[model samples]
Target: MYEYKCVELRSKMFGGALSGDKLERVLNEWAAKGWQLKSTAAVDVKGRIGPGGTDGLLITFERQKG
Candidate 1:
């Protein structure tokens, strides 16, 4: 049988305005689940760390062969 899975990390300008370090942490955790950072997307809401703005990120994880 074939199995498939996915993980998504979203921070709507909360968690202290998501930073690369924090994002990396999320990526690392998911990485353990065989997930890797694939891509990311974001939009300006109002402002953020530098300026409150909305943001979105996409991560892709896939099973590997042994």
Candidate 2:
């Protein structure tokens, strides 16, 4: 069996550009905890002060649950 996790990566730039450095950091952090990236999906995520959503990525990870 395995466990799965979903993480949202939001763009901090004004022009809606995703940070590569941040992405690498998150991937490494989760990998250190035994999680491997399974998939990703581009999405528009709702923000705290926004009427519409912003561009973001939905990252999925999986790990053995034994």
Candidate 3:
């Protein structure tokens, strides 16, 4: 069995950069807790302008059930 986690990255919070020290810290923190990255993808956040207009990132992680 496995467990999963999702991390959302917002452009406003990250200044449009996805990979950074903050992200690394988060990953490391989870890694220490036995989580591993499974996948990542660009997500389009719905905005006032239109759908698929806002840039975002989605990080998926998985870990063995304990």
* Winner by TM-score: 2
Each candidate's TM vs. the true structure?
0.49, 0.82, 0.70
The regions of model 3 sitting more than 4 angstroms off are 46-53
Runs in model 1 lying further than 4 Å from the true structure: 1-8, 43-54
Best by lDDT: 2
Model 2 Cα lDDT, one tens digit per residue, 5-41? 9998878542566677778888999999999999999
lDDT of 1 by residue, 1-66 (tens): 323444444565346467888877777887787654555545434442575445555455555444
1 or 3: which has the higher TM-score?
3
Ranking by lDDT: 2, 3, 1
RMSD value for candidate 3: 2.9
Report, for all candidates in order, the number of backbone clashes: 8, 0, 0
Q: Give the TM-score of candidate 2.
A: 0.82
Residue 36 displacement in candidate 2 (angstroms): 0.3
lDDT of 3 by residue, 1-66 (tens): 999999877665676665678778878988998999998888875655555556777889999999
**Deviation from native of the Cα of residue 37 in model 3, angstroms:** 0.2
Residue pairs in clash, model 3: none
Worst 10 residues of 3 by lDDT: 45-54
